[model samples]
Target: MASAVFVLAPLPLGSVDLAWVCIWTAVLSASLLTARVDHGCKADLWFMVPILAAIAAIAVIVWIQVAPNILANLQDPAWGNARDLAGIDVPGRISLTRSSPLLSFGYYLVFVLGLSRAYLLGIDGWQAHKLLKLVAYASVCYALYGILSQLLLPDTLLWRQKEFYLEYATGTFVNRNTAATFWGSGGLILLIMMVRSILHKSDDADSARVRFLDRPATQAVGCGICLVAVGMTGSRAGILITVLSMVCAIVLYLAPLNRGGWLLWTSVRNSLVAGIIVLALVGSLAMGRISQIGLVDGQRYEVYKTVLDMIRGHTVLGFGAGNFDAAFPPFRPASLGSQGIWDRVHSTPLELVLDLGLPAATAVFAVAVFFFASLITAALRRKRDRHIPVIAAGAFFLGSLHSFVDFSLQIPGFGLLFACVLGCGLAQSISTSTRGLARRAPDWDSPILR
Candidate 1:
């Protein structure tokens, strides 16, 4: 039930829906605790502790700045010019963020706790697979809605006012890039399922024969639909990253197959050909939008430079979390032409540095790198239940790569989904008891593993 709500909570594009989802998630987490489920904390708690501590430190920094005496005592001369440029008085109680820092902290807490609960759920193999299937199905449904809405009602968003990007498939998301990210994730999941189906070998004589209409074919159709929806989003980064993720999935699938070198090469060639064909079809419909990737968008580049300046001013402690918009106006470059509000720097990494400063951001990044590395190592080494890790790795790659150029990670829906995948991957990597449980339980390996 919690999984379903998590999958659908992004549709409304409001905070209330996410808050309700968080409440239900907390309830579900409490129930799991009562059941005494292994939360996979033994493997990741060390890393998580530092991240939590960093958040706490940032909170402290925000709180202290609110007190005039503390702010004056800690004032730096280097910040004087930036303060004058921003037109804000020194030692004032106002936080750097446009919104309340306490609210941002609450949201971050919910996200972290939600991720921990997902890890617990994923320690159980059956539960993990069920959650993956549910998320995949929900993503596909959203993709269909996006495609249909764009074709039938291009002028409206969920039957409401269409303020912008009417021609693109934004789905239930406010941004086309975010919608593409969601669809791309769904495509990766379907791709993994399709590969697993193809590689499946059944011992039963009746199941040994391959049929024209099979699970793999069905998954392939779904994957194609998702890819098409991603292309329709008309986002260059989205299409490229999604394609790269698919290629990664194909490579992961081909790696462990016990096939001859010639056969493997042929399979790779065929997969590449299929990918090209899909791209060509979608590209035609996109009408040269993919070609725009070669051009540089000066506005985002300018914003990136201004954000770097902001980071330079606050080398130790950042302005504040969720403070990008409020902290940006003073550093806004005249070259940006003063036409639009640069709320986000459009790069998650830079924004993290801006919000948390270098030290805290570095700590957070190190933890992420360690987590992903652990999962990838497990995926490569594990003899059984390898698909879960592979899928998680692919999903992580999609989100991480997109973060370098877009703010997909800042969006609650994408962030929650990414965290869920990360938790599941970590759980699969480190949960010894779950493996033991699987062995003691009934041998319910699907036909794919038989």
Candidate 2:
């Protein structure tokens, strides 16, 4: 249900915002009505503290950006210039607009709510498996729709005209890069399922090998279709990052070779060979597109340089949250060309620094590092469900790497999807033993317990 609302709404701006309303409502309702607080799982949720703190810090900065200079040191020289021209005192602070950051808080809520909702449901191993499978199926459905639409419609999204990216398969998104990340995430999930079956980690390892081979390879073909959709997007970095992330996931799956005997060795060899074949064939799908654009986007590279300079000037307290569109005009270098309206920095970190300042961006980065470390810890600790945490970590890496060059994760739906996946996996990965339990629960009624 959560996946469909995000994946199907390709034309966004208003549509994306609406999707958030529905998602937040459903997640919140489910959380309030049915979500339980298991002592063990609640303890594990402490990992989200840094993330919440980062959000709060940005919120405070946004408030300060809008506060009166006399009160919060947010005076803008632009207001002075306006006052002199108008012959009347004009008051203004940092942010160009009041609503942008306040509206941006919605995106932040998506991250928090997505993870919270998923973590709540993921406490049960059964539900976690179901969640993973649901995402995988939805991805395949979207991938097939994109491939068919590119072939059949060619110029329309639903009933409306595409107007741009006519030749590229964008799935349900407006941008091909975002589509690539979306499908690539799906492709990665499919690959994880394949690896799990191949590893023969099922309780009945003896029969797992035969059952895996005997089963129809629908997911293999599904992965191919997903790759085809990704390739059709013609996003060079998207293709490269997706394939690299898949390789990393494969390596993580193969890490426990010591426990394997002759049977597992054969499975590993077959899995590796298949991985090589898939990489070469699917990678070739994007080769033509890569050749056309080469490695660097010249125009985009200049924009990145300008954004970097802007960040340097506003290192302490940035212009304002979601104020990049207003903050960028003065700093726009001539080399970037004055042809387009520049709002997004195309890089998440640069934009965050531009909006909330460097310290806040660092806090966000630290939160990510902490989560990655937790995932690694889980992978190392768990014997049975190791793939869950490892795949979650790999998924985060995929989105993070892509965010460096493109803003896929900035898209509310895509970011929320990853958050939910991470939340679900982390819920399962954490020890969840009696560690999160209170030591004094047994003595609650006794005076000594107090």
Candidate 3:
């Protein structure tokens, strides 16, 4: 339910309060239920500790900045400017905007709750698989609607008038890039399931080719729809990043097929070749659109340059959490002649550095890298239930790369969903303990075996 709420919300902004309430409610309810049934709410989701700790550290920093006169040195010049303009002493704090940091903290908590709930649920393979299936189906619904709505009501989204990107399919999101990421995410999961179906159905890869072509092609249809929607989004980086991640996931997931006790890299190569062939057919539109736009947006590149310049000055303490709107204006150069308010800097890590300082942002970034490595390692090591880890690993690639050029993962809905998926995969990847180490071995001396 938490995972459902994390992704199903129509708009990340308008629905955030409700999403927070719903997801946290689901988490608490699940915990209580587990305590009642299992006598405890124990979960081996230790892998999430690094990221969770990073969030907590950032939250603490925000709290400090929000605390009046606690660290007089950390207060921003904006607070002093307010006092000078009013000719009175105002509260000294680091954050230029109080509500923004508080709101950021709220979103962080919601994400953590979503991840925690998913980790617990994913411990049970049956339940975890069911949850993933539900998510995949829901994603297809999103893609289907996104594509249909583009055709029937290009200038509309849900009950509202869509003022921008009318030519593209954005589904519930306002930004085409975010929508692309969402669609691409769903597409990756479908691709995984489809590939898994092929691997699980037959032992001989060569023999399975004909059988695969003959089997029902339902998953392929879903993948195609998702690809089409992503293509229609017209986000070049989004399309390329997603497709590359899918191919990598395919290659890695099928890397070491142990047939007759002989490990073969042939299947890995074959998977890559097959992926290219299938994508050429299924993702033609998305692939075609990749060459439609130049690799970089000039305006966005300038923004990145300016943001990097800003980060150098305030590398220690940031402008404050969620106060990018407040911090960006003074730093905005006249050369970039855009009259629009530049709140988010298009790049999540750069924006994060501006909001949470270098250390905090680096901590967050490092955690992602850690997950990428851990999930891949686990995917290779684990025999059964490796698909879940594979999906999570691919998602790390998709989310991290998109984050460099877009802010999709920062959206409360997408962020929470990503967190949930990562948590679930990490939970499944770790080996479950079969027995307590403290428990004495079954009385071998007691002659039951004899």
Candidate 4:
């Protein structure tokens, strides 16, 4: 039930609040139902203490008012009397500069708790597999909906007036790129499942024929639909990144079959044939839109420069969490030449620096890199459940790359999904033993066994 909500929550404007409620409910329900709660990591408290402390520090910075003298020192000299002239209602108290600091904290807390829950759930392989299946099928449903909507109701989005990207497949999302990334992650899972089916062949030919319309074929069809939807979104980066992820999955799937040269060749040949068919279908639907990859938006570069300037001024402490829009107007570059509101900088890393300062942002980045490295190591060394780490790695790679050029990671749906995958990867890394260790295991009578 929670998995269903998580998968479908992205449809309603990315479901910022809805996702939080669903996750909170799921966590509480799981806690009540289970007798033994598996935290999944022995070092969980050691790792979590600092993270929680950081969150506490941020909360203090956001909710409490700094001394006037200290606040004055932090302000730019150019703002001169603005800080003094902006009269305060209370003598020693002033809210954060952010437009909605409490809201920002709420979102951050939700993500933290959600990741924790996902990690615990991922410790059970069966549960993780079920979650993966849910994600894939949900994506397929959304993909089909997006495709049909584009074909049948070009001017409407989810049966409402289309605000933007009229011709693109937005898939219940306001932005086509978000839809593409979400479905792209889903497509990767389906691709992995398809590859697994190919690698693990059934012995009984009669039974295999009887179950021809089984899970594998269904996954293949879902993957095709997702690819077509991604291509139709007209997002150049989305198509390229998704294709790269697919290629990575294919290489990983084929690399292990190299012991048998003929078998490896056969697998490659079959994969190529399937790839060609899927690509042809995607191409027909996209109508050569992938060629637009070369086009670059200069406005984004200007925005990035402005964000850098903001970061430099607040090198130690940021303006405030969720304060980008409020803090941006003063730093808006003249070169931008736009009167429209600049809400997001289109770069999550730069935005993070602006929100949490360099130190905090660095801490976050380091943790992420550590988990990614651990997952990569586990994927290469572990004999069983290797696909789990591979899928997680692929998801992380897609989100990380997309974040550089776009704000897909900032969207709650994509952010939550990425966190879930990361948690699963972390769980897999801790639970699986290295091949060498497994080989060295002794028999029941051995001293080591005791």
By lDDT rank, best first, the candidates go: 3, 1, 2, 4
Ranking by TM-score: 2, 1, 3, 4
| Poorly placed runs, candidate 1 (over 4 Å) | 14-35, 38-41, 44-68, 71-94, 97-99, 202-214, 258-270, 284-287, 290-295, 431-435, 439-450
Tens-digit per-residue lDDT, 11-62, candidate 4? 7767656455456546535643552344344554434454466567666765
For residues 1-450, could you state the per-residue lDDT of candidate 3 as single tens digits? 455564565354324464455555566456535531231123353454665687679778888768787677767878888899988777888787767887777666666766767776766554555567666666778889989999999999888899888878888888888878777887787788777765554333364344332233766777778888887887777777878888888766766454432344666566668667755654555556655655677778988998899878777768788888878888888878967667688999898898888988888777777777888987777655677888888877898899999888777656765766787687767744431112111111111111
Return the clash pairs for model 1, or none: none
Which of candidates 2 and 4 reaches a greater TM-score?
2
What TM-score does structure 3 among the candidates reach?
Answer: 0.84
- Give stretches of model 2 more than 4 Å off: 1-15, 18-33, 39-42, 70-74, 87-90, 204-216, 258-276, 432-450
Residue-wise C-alpha lDDT for candidate 1, range 1-450, written one tens digit per residue: 457545865677522344654664566456446543544445556545654675577677556534453454334343465567887665444346434555556556656665666676777765776677677767888889889999989888885887778878888888888888888998898788777777666454567555543378778888888888898898877887787777776776566563478877776787778767766776553436635545346788888888888788776657666678877886788898859867788999998887666887887788788778877786666655677778888899999999988898777767777777777777777644534554322212234222
In order, the Cα lDDT scores of the candidates are 0.70, 0.70, 0.71, 0.67
**Local accuracy of candidate 2 as per-residue lDDT tens digits, 1-450:** 454443443335313564555656465555546666654444654765665676678778877777656443445566667778877675677766656776776677666766766776666655665677677667788889889999999897766788778978886777888888888887887777665654442333354345332233766777778888888887888888888788777666555543457755665566567656765676665677667777787877888999888777677777777788877788888887768767788889888888887887888888888888887777656654556777787788889899998888888657766876788777767653524432221111112111
Q: If candidate 1 were superposed on the true structure by all CA atoms, what would the RMSD be?
A: 4.3
